[model samples]
Target: MRDFLTKKITDIQPSGIRKFFDIVSEQPDAISLGVGEPDFDTPSHMTQEGVRSIQEGRTFYTANAGLIELREKISDYLLFRNKVNYDPKTEIVVTVGGSEAIDIALRTFVDPGDEVIIPQPSFVCYEPITQIVGGTPVTIDLKAENQFMLTPEELEGVLTEKSKILILSYPNNPTGGTMDREALIKIADVVKKHDLLVITDEIYAELVYDEPFTSIAELPGMRERTIVINGFSKGFAMTGWRLGFMAGPEMFMEQLLKLHQYTIMAAPTASQYAALAGLKNNWQETVEPMRLSYEERRNYLHHALEKMGLTCYKAKGAFYLFPQISQFGLSSEEFALRLLDEEKLAVVPGSAFGKSGEGFIRLSYAYSIYELKEAIQRLERFVTRLK
Candidate 1:
């Protein structure tokens, strides 16, 4: 028999989220906050536009770089919102989703054995994709004291000649951490010293609260060296749309666009049309309600966790709360599994994000207020038994 499996594919672990999702599916009436996806339906105008695009027979393949109008609109949107400018023609490539964008960016830049710097308690894709591309994933643990933001001091400690890419994900996954301009500037200083390329996942950029969002691309000398990975997934509740894009230096785009062209061909045509409406019309109607709702959930969960005697940080963006559970004297995985099996509540262990997350558990507040209240009640019941 032939040993047929490729090492790269064989070595990778399956998604931590999917592992739990399959479990929750088997249990009747389970309440799941384990997944990071938005519970809201995709906006109406976007759906109508997508159907209209299909009815008009616009289903043929778009350019590998994506529709020029969409790309240009993306450029304008980035410039206007993130204060980061990019040229649509040469500097951007639309991808299947932010996931694909992340993979392409790594595939384009990571030569065999190149090192990628990642912050812990981040979205899981960063490290796995880096490993699949034959890059070393160096994880820097972001602590609760820092609001889970990666520090420049930590960046300096990990630098080596092999380090090629730095992935900055904020408002982060699981932890809901975000970096302000000052924190980013400090990071920029280290990046400048190390001369590294940054692959920033700002998928949660539009979901921020209390403070304005900042993009690393807006840093001086950063736009050219940073590839900004964003998409319609989190912002427009378009996870199923599978539409995302990346903007960076033309040289990098030349490589990423090539990979996108050869592999994905183009992002889904109907989804792109829907995204066009998303980018232009109904922007506020689509995202604002979801953002406001998540903010409320964020505050509710934070306070609720505190009231239950868990130490929780203020989650500035994204819909998750990473609460320290060391007081419970259980590993994060034990806490999560017991909560699911005994309580019919589904939440992910923070350790699933990284070792730094071992003492915490991540609860997604993307669910409704009523559901959140129920979850809090269940959690309090579980905690009462813990004593």
Candidate 2:
């Protein structure tokens, strides 16, 4: 037999986040701040709705695009919340999760040899997914000095004739950085100049710590060219439900919907109905409380890291703390490994995100304040010994 797998996939690396997670799982009494999942369960109402879905025996596949009612609610949510408008009937397609939404959008838009400008240290999926589709990833290693927000200059520098897409994940992962309206306008100008389509992953849209989250698509002339990705996982504490959606212009969505139909068929039926109930109640009941909890966790972790003499950009969104581990003369991986081995504490190496993340480690604050506090004590012990 010849080689089993294609070189494209074989050459791609597995997620850095998962590597530490696996190791931590084997360590007895280990405290992992690695995975970026919420500690909260699916709110009772949403769970009950899913239960209702099963009780009513409405477990059949939904429309290829999803329930029109759910789509309408999503549309309304986007309009009222993110300041973007899409016709639910034609423009929104609920997906398995934001992960699938990203995969489908990249598949539909990118062609072989096309260049995708991705800002680092971003979510780990974008580069590999671009490669899987035969697209070239052009990385703009974001700087902490700039608060990890992607700059227009940084974006403009990487443009090429083959540049087909720009993935903007604000209220970002790993670093928890966010871009406000002014920052977005500058990016929009560059996108317009380059004529690039954007996949704005606003999965953390509801968790912005400062101003309300703004979608790049909300800007003038950007909606026609941007696909907004969001989901029920983080804010709604429905990660297991596997429900997410995409909002974009009809031209892109019609074809994206066709691809989703052939590939996924439709998102799970019970999950859709459960999500519908979530939206019908406007999501505030669950989301607001989770956001506040995450903020509290963020503050506690931020202060703890500060007290340890580690400096990092204070996260403005999402539930992560990316503190620099370089001062101790250890690589991100080494620091994480030593911490896990010696203190039984687990955090993801920043290098897992991208090369620019080499000297940092990412700690998710989605865990309870109690766990975060315990994790901090272990981390403090580790850091003190290192010093």
Candidate 3:
């Protein structure tokens, strides 16, 4: 079996974040902010729909491209919410989740030894998935001074002829940084000039606070050169449902669709039916309240971290508060582990995302206000003990 496995399988590194979780899994009464998922339960209406489908015997295979009704809703949602237009028939493909969508996107575009540019202090999956497909992951560190935003100069510096894919993940995981229209325009200009293809992970698109989350695909020429990856996970608290979709140029999506056909065939049929309901009538009622709750939590967590004298950038979107922990005289991992072991409070080390995250620690505010207050108290006591 070992001899039969491919060289690529041997070259991959196990996920760094999962290692910590495994060690702490048996601990008692730990207050965890380690996972990047929403603490909220999947919306009841969506779940009911899934149940209804299963009861009605709708448990069969779906089209490789997914249900046409679902595709149309995705197209409509993109256009209505972000002013981005995609053809339902050609540009859209329902994926297992944002993870599978990202994997498919990378596999379809990246050839062996091709370099894919990723902004660091971003998501953990990009590098591992790129390596899986034989692509070289080129990381560009987004500076804290720039509010963790990627600059055009950074993009220009790293991008070479071998760079086939550029992943833009904003409302970014771990950092909670997001790009506005002007920032996206700068990167879009660079992408256009370089003739590069962008695979944008906008899963947290609906969680913005101060400014609207702009898609690079909305920019001129970018729509044709961009693959938009989004899902119901962050926005609708639908993480367990494993539903996501990709929209891009027809020619590229054709290749991706074929890959999906061979690898997974299709997303869960019942989940597709439930997501169709989510995309249609229940979207506003089920999703907006959760967004508002997350926004409130963001404010609470940001202020609490500030009062505790930790340097924190005000996140524009997503549910994380990444605080600089260098003042505690420990690396990110040490700080995180010590807090979990001593204070019984769990937050992810920033280094789990990338090397750029070395001096910071990421805290999620997806839990209730009462729980957050309790966790913050533990953190405060932990810091005092350190001193």
Highest-TM-score candidate: 2
TM agreement with the true structure for every prediction: 0.98, 0.98, 0.97
Candidate 2 error regions (>4 Å): none
Residues 1-387 of candidate 2 have per-residue lDDT tens digits of: 339889998899998888778788898698889878889888888899899999999998889999999999999999998787789999999999999999999999989999999999999999999999999999999999999999999998989899989999999899999998999999999999989999999999888896778888889999899999999998888888899999999999999999999999999999998888888855687689889988988888999899989998889999998999889899999999999999998899999999999999999998987898899899998898999
Name the 10 consecutive residues with the lowest summed lDDT in model 3: 19-28
Which residue pairs in candidate 1 have backbone atoms (N, alpha carbon, C) closer than 3 angstroms, thus clashing?
none
For 99-196, candidate 3 gives per-residue lDDT tens digits of 99999889889889999999999888999889988889999988888999999999999988898888999889988898888999999989888889
**Total clashes in model 2, counting residue pairs 3 or more apart in sequence or in different chains:** 0
Q: Tens digit of lDDT per residue, candidate 1, span 1-387?
A: 237988788788887777767778898788877778899888888899999999999999998889899999999889987787789999988899999999888988998889999989888888998888888999998889989988888999998989988999989998988999999999999998889999999999999999999998999999888999999999999999999999988888998888888899999999999998888954766688889988888888888889888898888998888888878899988898899888999998888888898999889998989999999999889988997
Q: Which of the numbered candidates is closest to the native, going by highest lDDT?
A: 2
Per the 3 Å backbone cut-off, how many clashing residue pairs does candidate 1 have?
0
lDDT of each: 0.89, 0.91, 0.89
